[model samples]
Target: MHQVAPDRSWPLFDVAATRRIEQAAQAALPPFTLMQRAGLATARLALAIAPHARRIWIACGPGNNGGDGLEAATHLAAWGKEAVVTLAGDPAALPADAKRAWERLRQAGLDLAPAPPHDCDLCIDALLGIGAARPLQGGLAAAAQAMAGVGRPVLAIDVPSGLHADTGAGLAVRATHTLALLTLKPGLFTAGGRDAAGQVWFDDLEVPAGPEAPCALLAGPPLAQPRLHASHKGSYGDVAVIGGAPGMAGAALLAASAALHAGAGRVYLAPLDPAAARLAPGLPELMLRDWSSLPLPSLAVACGCGGGTAVADVLPQVLPQAASLVLDADALNAVAAQADLQALLRARSQRSLPTVLTPHPLEAARLLGTSTPAVQADRLAAAQALAARYACVVVLKGSGTVIAAPGQPPAINPTGSARLATGGTGDVLAGWIAALLAHGLPAFEAGQAAVFRHGQLADRWPAGEPLVAGALAARAGG
Candidate 1:
């Protein structure tokens, strides 16, 4: 078993794929071998996490997940530890393998208890696993509440009860550590999963993954490419940032500054508000120019960071002309509002022009003609739908930023924290993606790399210092 971290990429399976893998493994192995492995792994990890604990409460449910708990309790009891077991369902109702496990538990001289021991050091939540399709009730609900109120470390088996293994929805058991058996799930790394499963660990039960493809990938850090000694500034290409109407000119300047710091060969600031030029003195490296003066066909453009209502006017020219484009914030809103611009945006894919759309949940909902709650309900589906609809790369920014492209598996970025909740961070990400695009990376790769880096910055931000957008933009390429 190994702990899940962001240092390496991991395949993320949905409920269907995990079920298939489990079935294949069970067919190839001896009867009850998988459950034995899972139980042993759980017992060992529990010991490792709480070595000195005398009392360990194991909450067992009606399914095989409960059997895993029963098997674990037997081991813990044999090891001279106080194993308190609670069964929420009848032993006779359990499946074949689970019935065998229950018999073993009885043979070990352990009996079911009425409720959790009040003084237990650690609680093992095995009430529900991936099969939790409904809300908690009865004994399961009481156990969940007890575990939550205990304020001690709770180790969950397979998955936290009530969380959708694929969608990451539901108010689930908040486990301090979740041991993913057989396969790593996508939900554990995204949405409410991160909060529900605090520290993720994986044990494949000695079974290899089946031929089934992963639904998504937990993205790792990008590989750093060494710059050639003889390379000049022009080798990186140019970036043009257009937006910043009236009072929001700082948004456009932030994008320009980010591109400059992120290694763009030349950064141009094309502000819609004429008075916005005065703000350029702070970032003198950015070349201030009129939006009409830019040669859109030759530049990588990041449009609509704080463009307000003015961004809609420029989409007609930007959609068809820019060599490559990253449409963000207001630009995404503009496309959602105008059917003609949406058609123009879609046409770019037909012409082999690379385009990426970075939309927060609200912007994504607007584009999909749905509510934010609906989009948030299934972020992977929302991102995939947007990518398919626009025929371009889509970066659905949220708790777990998702990057999806046509015909490619979506990637969930695992490197960010709540520090990135500040305003203008999205603008910074837009510029960072523009820089990568300017450096000649493909649209999907650019989005992935930039989002990874953007979140990584927040993850590594100094503890006491506030993580503001300007500082984040300045450190884009770091």
Candidate 2:
């Protein structure tokens, strides 16, 4: 078993794919072999996590998940540890594999306890695995509550009970460490999965991935490119940032500064507010210009950082003329409000022009004409829909940012932390992506790399020091 980390990319499977893999593995192996492997893996991991614990509480359910718990309890008992096992469902209703496991536990001179111990060093949650589709009730509910109230480490088998293995939706048990068996589920890395499944570990049970294609991918660290000695400033290309109406000049300046720091050959700032130029003395490297003065056709333009209502005036020109474009913030809102701009945006795809849209959940909801809750309910679907609708790459920013393109499987970024919750971070990301685009990266790869690096900065931010947007923008290229 290996721990899941962000150092390398990993394939993510949905519930249907995981079930298919399980079925194929079971058909090829002897009866109950998979369960035995799962149980042994669970027991070994439990020992490794809490070796000194005398009492280990194992909560077993009515399905095969419970059988895995029963098998684990037998091993723990044989190892001279106090294995407290409790069955939350009727023993007579247990499945074939679980019945066999129950018999094995009985043969080991162990019996089910009426209740969990008042205290234990570790708690194993096996009440519901991938099959959990509804809220917990009865003995399962009580078991979940007990595990929560205990305040001890919880090692959940397969998946935390109640979390949707496909969409990462639903309330679930919060596990300190979750051991993903057979395959890694996408839900564990995105949406509520990141919070529900802490310190995720994976054991494939010695089975290889089947013929099924992955539903999504967990984005890894971007590959580093070395700059050549022959390269010059012009080799990187130019980036133009347009936005900053009135009081929100800081937003546009933040984007311009980010592009400058992120290795753009030349960064130009065009503010909607004429007075905004006076406020940007700190970034001397940024070339201040009128929006109409820049050659839009030759530049990678990042529009709508803080354009407010003024951004609507520029989209008509930016949409069709810019060589490549990244529409963010108010630009997205403008397009969501105007059908003509939406049509213009769609025409760019037909012209084979590269475009990327970076929208937070609310912006995405506005573009989709849906509620934020609906968009967040299935982030992957929402992102994919937006990409298909606009015929461009869509970066759905949230707890687990989803990057989707027209014909490719979406990617879930795993690099960021809550420190990014502060203001102007999205503006910083927009500029970072613009820099990558100016450097000649494709829209999808640019979004992936920028989102990964942007989050990695927050992930590596020094503890005790505040992580503000200005600092984040200044560190973008690093």
- Candidate 1: residue 14 lDDT (0-100): 94
The digit string of per-residue lDDT tens for model 2 on 1-478 reads: 9999999999998989999999999999999999999999999999999989899999998899899999999999999999999999998899999999999999999999999899999999999888887888999999999999999999999988878887777788999999999999988887888888888999999999879899999999887867789999899989999999999898898898899889999999999999987665488889999999999988999999999999999999999999899999999999999999999999999998889999999999999999998987899999999999999999999888999998999999998989999989999999989999999999999999999999999999999999999999999989
Clashing pairs in 1: none
Question: Candidate 2, which segments miss by more than 4 Å at Cα?
Answer: none
- Per-candidate local distance difference test: 0.92, 0.92
lDDT (tens digit, per residue) of candidate 1 on 1-478: 9999999999999999999999998899899999999999999999999999899999988998898999988998999899999988888999888788889998999888887888799999998888887988988898899999888899999998878888787889999999999999988877888889889999999988869899999999998957789999899989999999999998888888899889999999999998877664497688989989999998999999999999999999999999999999999999999999999999999998899999999999999999999998899999999999999999999888999999989999998999999989999999999999999999998999999999999999999999999999999999
Total backbone collisions for each predicted model: 0, 0
